[model samples]
Target: MNETTTIFGIRAVIEAIQNQKTIDKIYIQKGLSGHLFMELQQHLSGGEYNMSYVPVEKLNRLVKGNHQGVVAKISPVAFADLEEVVTASLEKDTKPLFLLLDQIDDVRNFGAIIRTAECCGVDGIVIQKKGGAPVTADTVKTSAGAIFKIPLIKVDHIKDAIYYMQASGIKVFAATEKTEDLLYSKDLNQPLALVMGNEGKGISPSVLKIVDEKAKLPILGTISSLNVSVACGAFLYEVVRQRL
Candidate 1:
C-alpha cells in the first residue's frame, strides 16, 4: 500500500475514526473480544472499513509495533464516483467530453494520457476496474497531481460503459489506425466519449462493436501507429477545435 495508518490500541482506532480517515480495511487479532472490542466492532460495523480477525502471525508481519489487536489500511486517494461526475457535467449544461481507456496498461502512458486529457479540458476519464493500469504512485506523480483534479472512474467493462454513455445520449468514438474512416469526417462537437486502446491489442473487439464511429488519425508517417496518448491528444484536440 502507498499509504498506511497504524493504531495499536482500541482508543487509537477510535481516534482514527474520529479524524475521518477512509480506512480500506481493518485487522483485529484472533480470539479478541471485550468492551474495547465491542466498541471497535460497533465503530467498524457502521463505517466503511472492511473488518476481519487474523492471527498474531499476520499482525507481526504487518508491523513490529505493539499493536493492541488493530491495524487499519488507508487508501491514498479518494475515488471518483461516476454518477456524481456524470450528473455534475450534465447539470453544468456542457458537452461531456469523457475519455475511456481500453486496457492501456503502462503507468507512464496512463499518466501522459491523463496529462493530455486534462490539458484538453476533458470532463472525466474512465478505465476498466481490472485490465487497465491503476492509478499507482507512478501514475500520480507522472500526472503531476492532475489525477486529483480530474474525475477517474473504473468500470467493469468498456462496452457496458459505452452502452450507458450512448443511452445517456453520448456518442463514443474509437480512435484507432485500424479504421480507414478519417476523424475529420465526423462531427465531434456532440456529447462525446473517445476510446483509446492498449499499447499492444488496441481496443477490444467487444468495445469496438459498440462504438458509434471508428475514427482514425490521418497518418502519413512511415510508422504504423501513434502512441496511445498522442492519438488521444489528436482526438481530443479535434473535439476542442470543433466545439470552439
Candidate 2:
C-alpha cells in the first residue's frame, strides 16, 4: 500500500483541494490568519471537511516542513460511485450483497470489515463521508491490501443509501440486538444490503426504522455484545452459507 500523502503549506493545500483530491482530514493552527490562508478558506467554504484547529506544535508533529499552519492528508485510493457500483452489480447474473457501515469509527475495524466483505463476495461497501473513521495509513495496513480489491463508495448520509437500496429492490437488513429474530432465521439467499452501526451506539434509531428487517446473533455467552467487525463477519458468512 502507498503511504498516506501529506500536503502542507497554505498554497499547496489549496492546489490539492482545487484538484479535487480525496482529503481525509485537515489540521490548521489555532488563530491562524494570512492572505494565503484566506485563499484556502475560500476554497473550503460550503463543504464537508474534517477540519481541526490545533497548536503549531501539532502541525509540526504532523509534518516536518513549514506547514504555514495547514496540513491535509489525502486518501491513496479513489472512492467509487454508488450509482455505478449498484447498477453494475444488479446487472450481474449472481446475487449481489452490499455492506453498509454507519459511522464505523475505528480504522482497524473498518479495515477488517473490508477484508471480510471481500472474502464473502460483497458487491461493494458504502460509508458516509463524515462522522466516520478517516482512511489513513493504519486503515490501509489493517486491510492487508484488500482495500484495493473492493469497491468503496461514499455518501453524504447512510439513510440515503438505504433509500436507494430499497428503491432498487434489494432487501435491507440491520444487524442489531433490538429484534428477536436470530440471523440464521433470515432468508439470506437474495440481493441484500446489511447495515452495521457504530461501535458504541449500534444502528441509529432513524436507520432501524427503515430497514426491511433486523436480526441478531445468538449470544449465549455472558457478554451481551461483540465487536462490530466480528459481528459483521458472522452476519456476512451467514449470507454466504445460505447461498451455498
Candidate 3:
C-alpha cells in the first residue's frame, strides 16, 4: 500500500469522507468508540463507504502516525457518473462503446482492461462500486497510465446499470464461455456496452438474464476460457473492427 494513497488519523478521515473524497475503504481499530468515531459512524450510515474493523497492530503497520484508530484508502482516480457519461456520449452524436465489469477484483486485470478499453476507443468503463477493484497506484501502473485517460463510472450494481443502458437503447452483450452465441456473429457496430464478469464465477445469472446478448470467444485449444482481460480485449477489438 502506498503511504500517499492513505489518509490516517480519525479527524482527517472524517474530514475526507465529509468532503466527498473518493475512498476505497476505511479501516478502524476493533473496539474503538468515542464521540469522533460516533460522528464517523453517522456519516457512514449513508452506506456509500466500506469499513472494516482491524486490530490496532494492523492499523499501526499501515501508518506510522497516530491513526486515532482509523485509516482510509483513497481511490487513485475520481469515478464518473454513469448516467452523465452515457448522456454526454449520446449527445455527442457518436456511437458509445462501454465496458461493464462485474466483480473484477484483481487490480492488474482491471488495469489491463482499462488499457485495452482506452486503446479501442471505448467511451467509458462501468464497474460496480462495491465488488470491483479499487483504482489504486498499482492499477495506474499496470494500466501504464491509461486509467487516467479512460472514463470510469462506478455504479451501485451491475444489473441496474445494464437495465439503465438498455432503457437508453444501448445493447449490452455479456461475454461468457457458457454461451453458444459466438462473438463474431453479433452486430457490434452500434451503441453498445460489453459486460465482462468475475475471473472465476463468470457473470452472475441475474446479470446474464438481463443482458441483450451473451457472446463467447472461440477457444480451439484445451483451455475452456480465456483470462477476463484477454477475453475483454478480443471483444473490444472486434467492436473496433466492426466499426471500421
By TM-score, who's the top model here? 2
- Per-residue error for 189 in candidate 2, Å, reads 0.9
Ranking under TM-score, best-scoring first? 2, 3, 1
Clashing pairs in 2: none
RMSD of each: 6.4, 1.5, 2.2
**Candidate 1 similarity to native, TM-score:** 0.71
lDDT of 3 by residue, 136-232 (tens): 7778888888888888888889988899899999999999977898999999999999999999999999988889998999899998889999999
Scored by CA lDDT, what does every candidate get? 0.80, 0.92, 0.88
* Model 2 bad stretches (over 4 Å): none
lDDT of 1 by residue, 1-244 (tens): 3433455667887877878865545778999878987987887777444566899888888778877788765545666777677777777666999999998989888988888889888889988755667555677778777777788876667887788888888889998776779999999988888999999899898888889999898778799899887888888998999999
Which pairs of residues collide in model 3?
none
How does residue 219 of candidate 3 score in lDDT? 93
The prediction achieving the highest lDDT against the true structure is 2
User: Which residue ranges in model 1 land beyond 4 Å of their true spot?
Assistant: 1-75
